[model samples]
Target: MAFLEIDSLHKTFGANTALHHFDMKIERGEFITFLGPSGCGKTTVLRMIAGFEAPTRGTIRLDGRDVTHLRTRQRKVGMVFQAYALFPNMTVAENIGFGLKVAHRPQSEIKQRVDEMLQLIKLPHLGERYPWQLSGGQQQRVALARALAGKPQVLLLDEPLSALDAKIRISLRQDIRALQRELGITSIFVTHDQEEALSISDRIVVMNEGRVEQIGTPLEIYNYPRTRFVASFVGTLNILSGHVIDPSTGRMAVDGQELRTAQTLPVGDAGKKRMLALRPEAIVLEAPAAGRNTLTATVEEVSFLGAIVRIRTRVKDEVISLDIFNDPNRRLPERGQPVALGFSHENLLVLEEGVQG
Candidate 1:
């Protein structure tokens, strides 16, 4: 049996629907992320799992026990919020021990658990400090420590690192993952940041408009997105219209240029206008070689983003982006300079032509 199961979950607030018929099964100790833009039901699902929001129509089972109607305190789940919901009046150690204290544990046991949690979060020296005295990252760690103090079966993180700076966010996320692994806890993280979800999660569930768009590992979602929403929302993609020439010969025309794809075309007749996707790294800003398709374009913009250089080029009427690793010895492309972009047929991804709300 799966460790956590959300079956046919549906949620609504008055006239509007927040989540629809969502279903997922997660194994024990696996890290899962609910990723999407705001109001896409990612948070709603997380709330339901944490027993904060009851589902309107489906049941939730954790460890094979039905928990759909349980209150937040009755469920064995710990949660950390994005706002660092630490009490201002309480000290760090007091905050961490609050959960244990509420359960009427012995004072000796509470102190021991509080000290252990402080050490685990590596803030043992600041136990006496209040939330207002701690740094943003430190306060968040205290929140995390407080959440874990109860030794809950599952930990739910609701965009915990969203408030920190980029460097601190990266560091804290690493710390959280390490701590989660060490404790072997089943966890669910909610985030709108694609890079965060891709980097930290064992699996990601992408949602939009109260519906799930795709669920897979980061590589699978990025490399072979099954839906147009998944393809466009996950990362930088070069989307364009492709006219089918001959399916048997694997021929197609994009931007008035002929190209070939090794992937099997969708069941369709000739002259079908299909949308195609390609990653920025797939195209090289150079002349085309054998077994590659070449597109003539003019450099429109060049952006040097620390470790990578993004070059935007105009081909016919469409703008395509290409990413290349930054090298000090190479010259940057100039605006209006004509260039050739080359890509192999297998690199092109065929996408269904539709809009996702």
Candidate 2:
């Protein structure tokens, strides 16, 4: 059996359904991330696992034991919140040892465990300081340490780094991933940030309107999104309306321009209008090599985003965004100039037209 399993999970508040028929199984010691926009039910799933909210209908199993009805404290799950829920009056050591104290562990054991956690978080000398004396990043580290001190079966991080600055958030996320791996603890992280999820998770569960849209590794999720929402939400994609011309040959027409794709149309989807998804980074400014798809477009806008150059071009009436790595030798085309945009057929994905949720 999987270490963590959620089966047919459903949550409803009166007439509104927050989650529907959600199912997932996680391996032991794996880092999984629930990623989605606000009100998408990502946090609800985390809360259900942590026993903070009832599932309405579903079962949560941890290590073959049913934990759906267990109390939060009895579930032996550690949770770190975005707000850094540390006690202001308690010193770092006190906060880290709070769970052990509640469980009535021996005082000497608690001290040793706290010291080990402090060293693990790289703040061994800060034990004497209170929460107020620490920076945002430091407080978050303490919160993480406190969560892990109990050695819970699973660690839940609910946007824990959302309150920190960008640089600090980046730094702390790396630290958290390293520590989680070293401890070999099963962890679930909830975040709306795409890059964070892509960077750290062993697998990503993309959620929408309380439904699991797609669950896969970062590369699979980014390169071959199964749903239109996943393609649009996970990264910068050019979703263009097109019609399937020949399903057998993967032929399609985009804005009246015929092109061949690497994906076949779904059964009964031929002759119907569909949406094609392509990553901005997949587009090339120069003419493609032989056997590649090429389109002529007029450059509408150019934006330099540090290490990347974003070019907005108009093909027929649709605007397509293309991202190219910034190179010192490459010259950017001016607005209103015509340029050839080239991409391989394999880079294009034929996505479902309508929203899933």
Enumerate clash totals for all models, in the order shown: 0, 0
Score candidate 2 by TM-score against the native.
0.97
lDDT of 2 by residue, 1-357 (tens): 999999989999999999988899999999999999999999999999999999999899999999999999988899999999899999999999999999999999999999999999999999999999999999999999999999999999999999899999899999999998999999999999999999999999999877888899999999999889999999889988888889988888888887789886666778988888889999998875688888789999999999999999999978999999999898899999999999999998888654444
Which stretches of model 2 miss by more than 4 angstroms? Answer: 354-357
Candidate 2 clash figure, as a count: 0
**Candidate achieving the largest lDDT:** 2
Alpha-carbon error at 42 in model 1, in Å?
Answer: 0.5
For model 1, the local distance difference test gives 0.91
Off by over 4 Å in 1: 331-333, 353-357
**CA lDDT for candidate 2:** 0.92
TM-score of each: 0.94, 0.97
